[model samples]
Target: MKHRTPRGFKRIPAWMFHSRLPVDAETRLITSYLLTSGSANHPTVSELSDALCMDAKTVRRNVYKLEELGLLKVIRRAK
Candidate 1:
């Protein structure tokens, strides 16, 4: 049987890689991973750390930096 890829896989625009935005290597990698994850759900710091093979604290720090740069936004949902 032929294997099938999952749906909702999106391609990161080439411009993002070569844009004027001052994004670092780590931030860009994390952003790309999130974009291709196929969901609007946000991943936790632990998840990001595990996926990126970086320390949780490091992931949290980078996430904050991304937020500061307006490259990533956090939306709160009521439970």
Candidate 2:
């Protein structure tokens, strides 16, 4: 299946790479992975990292950025 890049994520700026806005590449990547992980109803860092081929540490760090910008909810991690 051909995968289309999600909307609102085209031509993101290098300075905004860490922004929570959908236009940011890292943000878009993490968010996109979460959106497709069947975890939108209960998003988790590990699942998103697995889907994105990123490390948990990076996922955790970026998740913090997303949460700080009010783009994502960061509930406590599951045991």
Model 2: per-residue Cα lDDT over 1-79, one tens digit each = 9746766434322443344355445666775555444435656777677767888998888887878766564322211
Q: What lDDT tens digits, residue by residue, belong to model 1 across residues 28-66?
A: 667766776655368999888887798988888878877
Candidate 2: residue 70 Cα off by (Å): 0.6
**Once superposed on the true structure, which residue ranges of model 2 sit more than 4 Å away at CA?**
1-23, 73-79
Highest TM-score model number: 1
Q: Candidates' lDDT values, in order?
A: 0.65, 0.59
Best by lDDT: 1
